[model samples]
Target: MLRSLHLRAISPEAKKVGLAAFLSATAFAAVLGITAPAQAPVERSVAAPAAASPDSVELQLLGVNDLHGRLESPKAVRRETGGAPVDIGGVAALDAHLDRAERSHPGRTIRVHAGDMVGASPLLSSRFHDEPTVRAMNLMDFDVGTLGNHEFDEGGRELTRLLRGGQRSDGGQFKRDAAGRKANTSAPDFEGVDFPYIAANTVDREGRLGLPPTRVIERAGVKVGFIGVTTTATPNHVLDEYTERFEWLDISDTVNRQASELRRRGVEAIVVLAHSGAYDVNGDPGAAAGEIIDEAREMTGAVDVVIAGHTHSRLNTRVANSDGLGDKLVVEANSYGAAFDRVRLTLDLRSGDVTAKSADTPTTWNDEVAPDPAVAALVARYRAALGGMGERTVGRLAEGLERAGSLSEVAARAQRRLANADVAFVEGGNSRGSLAEGMVTYDELFEASSYEHQVMRMEMTGAGVRRVLEQQWEAEPDAPLHVAGPDEAALDDDATYVVAANALLMDQDQFTAFREYGRGVRPVGTDLEALEGWISSRGRETGVGG
Candidate 1:
């Protein structure tokens, strides 16, 4: 018998508003049925449908961000979730969840994603140019998705192909288009997704072509509008070359304009899917919720809800809109399908504006719900297709290595080899998991360096380097892993040394590279790139559990 956990459910009023926001025509289906799985079906709790009245509508937004190529369940993760864990993500499971939500709620539910759906994909997708991941997303019923930085990793044209859906070099897994007509097997999965890819902030320099300004979904009888905006700070953190063709706009301004237009069109509700982080003026998590409200208060009339990402935060705060008409909910689901944000907004059927709301993060307990057999079957197919590649060993370790504590040592060794500095340093958190004294495969390497990191070398002064070390060891002993700046200037701003880091970590404003160094900074080299080249040149051989 499959059991289900009762996650969070919204008030009936909120569902009405949510449904009102999505429906464009006067058609609605209110079929009362089980919204979630039965009790104790699996380890993780499946999300339940929002309860609502006949006049009220239910809109369920299923969001996922930063799923960086975790196509298979790692041994460690599998253990963490429990042996029969609910297999939280994967494309098929996502489909089951979607189908269950819609079926239970009938006409009120709609699916929407936050972003980071592609790029950094595993062998299955990356080997094929990340099209598989997009294909799976389309089948899973992604109504709309924003342009995450990874989507641009391959640049504009490639991303356009992915969105447009086309052929691949080595044929494809299936031969069907969105219209259910036989097509090329190599085609991507953008079929049947009639929704637009929105990026209100991303613009071509000439302003003629850019990501669709916004995507509108008409559900039930209400017209719901969604404006997608990724972080403008993206360029500051990501490789700028990929995004250079477009100009990232300000969230507040673009969303305000789009919301006004939506309201003008009789859209009952407005939502902003902002791939930006919530920060205080000082750029710290401790920043008050009021500070975030103020930062976004400009959209009182234009937008009703804001869904944030990038910081990988879980926000469930409610604040009154600048208009004081009602509260605007700011929500976010943590990455890796770990959880989801359920925001219920009550809309005045006559005014088409939100009246009341409540929001919360519903933890997805994989154990509580059964892994949809169809999804599990798809995973099996992909796993079988990959055949042995998933577990093939890339190299063998000479000896057993410590799990968490030894990361600093491994990083130090790599840094000395590549940078040849007095001391090599890396964040303890970056090197997750221990290296077992056995065959290490591609999967193991990915697990160890799963952050999609790039190696960045820079010159740091002797003084600056010493300061960084002290900060790492002393400033936050309790939180020893997270490095912070010291109060006094113990190092010279001009002295320099060679330091290696990933491109993702090299960005200053986002990761504070400049702030960490007192002065004299220049690129040196990267460790991972060197490792990849060395391995490839050696024509590395892999093995099994031997």
Candidate 2:
């Protein structure tokens, strides 16, 4: 479906000339000569940009977000193209899509990443510490990106190693022999990103800025300042062990501080590359609501556009800012390299402010172009490295598990069996993939639970176990807290029980209740390892998958 959003009111305003220009996604749909109804609608038009003059020049921003280290393609159907099933993801296809988009407007396009470039990934990338993903990003040439919650999954030190080249902490191409000499091995290739990843809201333990807040880029004599930030709710979602060493600043305050400084340095057009994300409410793109929406609306007038991610949803529309200067365009592509954004902005060469702007969201349809051969080869090499991985059937699922809750339940059960504990809990951390019905392989299990978190065995009384179960409901009404144990009715308050859970929960604030009763906490194998053991055992006994 080729379509564009056309608005009826709000032209150029004088205040916008020296001030700010806010707008949304309405112009790109028209590029294909298609009119669509799902786009965000304003009270007429959502644009607040200045009228175009001869001094105005066009600038483009190509954006992507929440890739999650998908080095290979995922089987997804493109909604815009009549729901035809095809391979739409993978670094190879994304490289192709980005290449084609950039060529259309040579020298005026900036490839942007909204965050989550790694973590919560498939076996091919996660096993190699996401080296393939970073290498692929460098190949595509991203201009600027921000930090997402998942990026901190392995802790701040490892993330630093990813951004700034350093020694591979774990398995890699070389190993130290008896003489401490480099030994050759078939390990992953590791390196840092070639682009700048900003983190305006991320702070160190001392409340000091951790990463560069903003970066200014000049195209066609027009300079646009980009501010990068993740949602402040990051600490809540990440491992407590990792988050304890860091602090999260407020999103709006962080952006304003950086935006103000950028303006003082003579930057007029400020674009925020935020890790925050939002969705079109009720299937209406214009009616977006989420943490990203709240941040967008609260942004000062100095900001122009917001490239957002994290919720892994679509948002192509204009929003009114708190400064009341005008509406600003907010765009987000879906996750796993599935889609991207092409935002066209009319920059006034005189004031350096965006005069007019419009954007469109396009799916990374590999069928549209020949996949980038280099990236495809890179993905192929990694797949071959894990020879016979697909054939190693761990267990069989009678039916596929599609939701995170189902997979979480599997994790919980595996941990219980591994620890021979009375129960196990699955909470916190991100669940990346789902299990398909049929014979489950080690490859599939890695995809199902990718987080590298150690499992902890805990001793708790039945009363405390009951309390934790109640706490799950207390936190969120009807929130599914994965637990593997005896029947609820059989759980006696006075009896003692052993619990298995991710090591992360012991430090997380939300699960602090566990600390109140947790005793004799000891480290068990990792969550993935437990699952592997459980599946292998089941696969051997049943001969019919789990």
| The candidate that achieves the highest TM-score relative to the unseen native structure | 2
| Candidate 2 lDDT score relative to the true structure | 0.74
What lDDT, from 0 to 1, does candidate 1 have? 0.54
TM-score computed on alpha carbons, candidate 2: 0.84
- For residues 113-183, what per-residue lDDT tens digits would candidate 2 score against the true structure? 98898988877777567777887777676888888998988777778878875556554445332244765
TM-score of each: 0.67, 0.84
Error of 1 at 54 (Å): 6.4
- Runs in model 2 deviating more than 4 A are 1-53, 78-84, 170-189, 206-210, 428-430, 476-478, 539-546
Candidate 1 residue-wise lDDT, 1-546, digit = tens: 011112323222123235453131112111212123455353334446555565566565555555554444333234354464344555444445445545544555556666776665555555445655654554455567777666676566666667765554333334332234654434343332334678887887745445677788766666668888877756754565666787777778878888777778778688877776553335433233442355467665657777777665667665566767665677776665565656655555556566556666655444435444323433444444444654755556555445466544454455444544434455554553456665566656545644445455566666656655555444333224322222234445565556555454444333353356624444454444333233333323421111
